[model samples]
Target chain A: MTSDILAEAMDYIDDDLISQAYSYSRGRPKFSKPLAVAALVAVVVVAAVAAIKYSDAFITAPDSGDSSTTAEYFGGFMPDKISDGELEYEGTPFTEKEISTFVEKNKYDLIGAIAAEYGDFESVYKISTSGYSHVNLGETNTLKYDYVDLPVCRDDEIIAKITLFRSDGGLSYTISVRGKAFDKYNSIYQGNLSAELAFFYYGFEELIITPTNHIYRVHGTEETLEIDRSMNYYEKYATEYNTFSYNELTDEKKYITVKPLPEEQINDGSAYTSSDIEEETAEAPETSTVRTVNIYVEDLMSEEIASVEWGSGYDLMLDRPFRVCTEAQKSEMLRFIENMKPTEAAEPVQYYGGGYIVRLVYADGTRASVVLMGGDQVYFETSEGESPIYVDTNGNASALAEYIVSLI
Target chain B: MDDTSIIKLYWERDENAVRETAAKYGKLCIKLSENILNNKSDAEECVNDSYLTVWNRIPDERPDYFSAFLCRIVKNLSLKRLEHNTAQKRNPEMLVSLDELQECLPSDNLPEKSFDARLLGKSISDFLRKQKEVDRCIFIRRYWYSDSVKAIAEDLGVKEDRISVTLFRMRKKLKIHLEKEGFCL
Candidate 1:
């Protein structure tokens, strides 16, 4: 049985699992149907334009070596008027009769269509399966479909290839996009025929293809693609938390702005503002011998990105508050604190982004803080000293700052 | 608020029931969604949707165990979201859990053996009833909620290796139990 079937079965008996699943009770919010429809229309138009532009170049055969095979394929698929090797979107659209005739003649099931852009050129690919048949699962039946690789050519160069097979009780399609460049060739698979095919460009370095509903917009040289703002709440959250812009590379236009959370919502202890920290310290025990350790880690590149904090029996930075450290974690932290050594001098090194600050409160109402710079060469600075220490392969740090990060 | 009180609020048609439920169980729903979806934003949406599902269902169905009722909705919703996201490729975490259970489960090729889902669920519940309380909880958490072994261990305040060993033994017992119940291995 599939995991889903088992999970469904378990749902009947498990109260805790059921409760955990339904713990969030905000009630379903209604979506704007008109906005959703508008977005869908925009996506369809973009896909259609891209498909027409790219497929036109590949479909029309020019006079060259082995041009007859290309001509025959085009003649069989395209109307006589368009088979003369002129690629134009303004030409007459494919009629229903032509589409049906093309499918029947090719002896394949037309599954779906996809379009992708690379630099100045665009490519459109068609998905189809040969020798596929619908069969009931309850009866013993022989599987159909012989595995075959069909090549699609452009100017005598094989630009795309399609391989079809059967697996997991359904037809599978593997579409490979090929080109003569580093990181140009990519393969995307569709286990089911009706799924949408998405192409994501990775910072001009690589192209990723998947069957996903999420829409992405390319930000030059950034590994992560920015989610389209017009999508769902999740897309908006991703854009706000995971993306950052380089001011030197491009003029900064703030695409994602995070509104400050309300005071009550902010008190969850997962994140603390500067004011909250100050207030907490103000209420600390004056004469108590209890040593309070607070550690704050930040992504130096993006100041807006939420920083992680560990202090006062809670890890406020984690998505969920780690109420208390386990015995092992406590020991590890102690070991890290003891191993920390004062540095002789601060070394000059390049800092790309991440760093940590550790605040230690002594029993005598004295406080000391340490700063650790993160990079290839890690530098540790304390109130009395600073030094460069070797970080081992196991990521053992010479200071509490690095050690706390490892624990988290 | 206690579960019975929440049910009472729903019975009284009080909107405060939704708010009270959110305050109490919202984090748990989000955690369950996060375990399955592995994306914070998707988890948040799934939790919100699950909350809405509870709001719509509770008036007609005052569940004996409110937590279970809520969790079931959220888990189902999260799984649906995951299915939509991974239509082309299976989620790696989900695939791993499924693969582990493959050894104990009847082969998918047994086309003639169409078993009723309710009967199978009853059989599983019977089997769990015979198991130790902790073992049953761990099994449900892993398979039903799709929680990571590390998470189960941490939640139970046990060592990760101990949890792994317990799960390994439990799966063996489940296989034997199912076999004894006349299902072909």
Candidate 2:
């Protein structure tokens, strides 16, 4: 046995497999303590900048260094004189008298410590409902909204509106004051309130902030209010970091040549085209005629696809197109495409070779064609006038390629 | 910095790319080399050489898996060093791992011109993909990284005997797979 040859052959092993072995053994890579600290500092700085830029009014500590100023502003302990404003609770408006009566009856703390401790209450009263359970992970995704807007009113004027934002690690409260309160509380001095506060002053339940999804269980009753915080999260964030283009590959770059299956062996099980075949100098014909807008692979809607077909230019046997038979398979195929990272294009020669081809026919009569190569790269097979585009599959293409090969 | 950012640095011809690569993957590359060469200085040298090769290769080849790409280089270089150092003296440490694979390899008598190391490697890779992740990891840890059975067991949190038995079964299965793929005589 040629053990030496076998030993050297280890070099060509798939990159993702190598990564999996390393990662499985080592677990996820962790930031060093210093790196973690640096990252935290950077996040804090960015948040501060964003707060200053976006917020109309900045809440500040009193110039006299007295916490009582904030205490007085929130009407500490004095339920009768807090404000003439009506505190809107879950669509039911309650006047200051009603709040004071409730506080008196319940023996609750009338002073809003959220204002005292945090040094300012922005006119906006923000409250996030509970996050939703992830369909795949079965864990609560700490996304902060499906936001319900509630206005804190002073007399007839709506002073603050609550805006909900999602948090994965924990619950957060950001109070922004507007109008008259904005003039009263807005200042240069800043204070940080990292924890979620439970107000005993009114009908509101204790806000539970947890690292997990088990948020806000009622004190005595078995009642639970679940909120879908992850609403539109994918539509908002996933596309931001994942968008890519094939403009990186230069004209001179060479791709692994894939050849059409031999004519005699087309549709037969034997003679799978080996990628080891020599490269031919011949260029692929300009077969692409479809023109698309600035659409990306991730932009393709699985529901809209009327048909999914896959074949290989290299394997003549698979030239008889294998249609995606199951909805699950179709979804899986689209999901894989969505996960592909934008990468540089290789030479347009891939359109001519042993590359795997997937054709998608949409219900609107739009057709899209993509080529998956042996190197775990994918490219949009363009038309006669369009440039070929490539994307990095990050090994997702291999899974897709395996699925396509399985059909054969 | 992320791998893409580091790769961009290389493409931009920034020298800091080497520093970043060393900072991020230096330990992994060294450990992989040490597993094979068994000499600390030689392993370090191999890792450094691998970094330089990465510096030169990138911009031309922006690897998606930067760690794997670097580790492969370090492993190859260490193997070359091992071959040179063991010309007169066989290193039993590495030989143990290779000998285990000897049972599954196809006939070595095929003419040199007929052997495509890459095709064989691709075949092995394709076969490995079909196995369970743990079994695949064990096979790669032992053969690709030249890790000791005890080390593999420790890394995987399994018994050394379990690793041994799994490797044995995997080799037999691989032989059958290769024979079916027409790689064996």
Candidate 3:
């Protein structure tokens, strides 16, 4: 068994696996813009400039004292008009009526926010399409839509693929306690998340949420989202600080606490920004083919692994759940078990009737009482731990164990 | 420099908008599409399509995260192309896989209760990470790290019938697992 252990893992690497992951043979998606590098570099530059400029403006109150005229333009006093939990738009640099009108005009993303406070009046009536903007995630996908030409609104998510344009009359969308976002006074606000808004306002990267789907790129770290009114959100989202009312705070004025949505539930796929929009198909003829490249992994480099069965005397000593299998498969599994460091191996043993307990030993001193059914149903698990080792993020597993009374 | 400004550059008919986008999300798009299509030409097509999609859709729409926005388009385009190719080839697995999701995933009729594609994807990943030893091995052997049931079972020394039943139950478990995570969104 020991001799066989060293060679087993080497046999498993399968050159096909690497190629499959690398080549995307199973109809995976590809991003192929010839000038992507230049685009990325420019984005960095732009982000830097926006960061520096907005950061400076956001930290100071836009209407700290000298800007009374600017204060009157934004209608910012509305926050005082509403009581606890009541949703209102008056005095809020953004008006409810404005978003409703925006949605009505575009009529592409037929999704309307059922006012969390007042169910009667639909909030943000902007945009629609009978299609009702939607998103569908499958086995292989990690995405966030932004700066797109389309809007997605559905019962589950409100994903706006396009970013708010500053040169336009629109403000970036704003979120209230009522669970909704709206962009009014286009160019006044950019419609980023509270965190993004904070960064935009404060000029500090302290508040931006990296997003969940991006966690893979961030090495799977789960980060929490933060938002506070002490930060002037308007400065980052609003292109024109004057969009706020007398009392409303702009980048240089006062800080209003903003609560970011719960990080756990934020659909990163729904995040969008303006500059990112040009990346999508822009008014070009549909001459480019539309498609998705999902790696089926199952289609390429499939190889047969040996299956094993537990011989007689395995039924009596077993406790709760039990399964059976062949010797060949068992040997192969045992070899795999031996390959793992001692700390990783499951305990191996063969339980028999009539008071006889025999622990099966692998060549590498690995012991297991595992049961493998016939064919390739290999059940390799550790009784000591809660989770098994071979599963990937998409719920893929290494094997399962089931007890079989008879042979096929 | 702002994505908002750059998008405006496009709507205002500025070609430098293309240069800006290329500077920001080009490699990410190229890599993503390339991973899916395997062919550079097809990958390029998907990326360009993504660009076109963004361009035509932006006037009435506003997004906060451009990378995610672009990624979704590229991914969807690539998947659509892949589906077309696979359908032309008459692959039974595609139909079976899709049919299996009919009961839980999004479709034309289901709205009030639908699954979060991203969360579901994550839940599946989480579930895989939680599987017990033998079960985990079987899963990897059948899905990710490996390919087919026959190969997985052969590697593990299990009967084909046993493997089939286990696979069935595994699928069932996955459905149940998703439900537990509020996959209905």
Give the winner by lDDT: 2
lDDT of 1 at B66: 85
lDDT of 3 by residue, B18-136 (tens): 77877776766775565445557777888888888888777656666554566667756876776566444433332333344343333344453343444455565566555433444
Q: After superposition, how far is residue A117 of candidate 1 from its true place, in Å?
A: 68
TM-scores for all candidates? 0.35, 0.36, 0.24
Candidate 1, lDDT over the whole model: 0.40
Candidates sorted on TM-score, descending: 2, 1, 3
Tens-digit per-residue lDDT, A1-408, candidate 3: 121221122123333332233232221111111233223323322232232221211111111121121112111111211112211121223233443344343232112112211222223322221111111111111111111112232221332222221112333321111111212211112332222121111100111221221111001112321223342233323223112221122222222111222222222423212232222323322332111111111212213212221211111011001111222223343444444332343533222211112233333544433333222222222232111111111112222122211110
Model 3, position A171: C-alpha lDDT score? 31
Off by over 4 Å in 1: A14-408, B87-91
List of chain B TM-scores, one per candidate = 0.91, 0.88, 0.50
- lDDT (10s digit) by residue, model 2, range B155-180: 54333654666676578668878887
lDDT of 2 at A228: 42
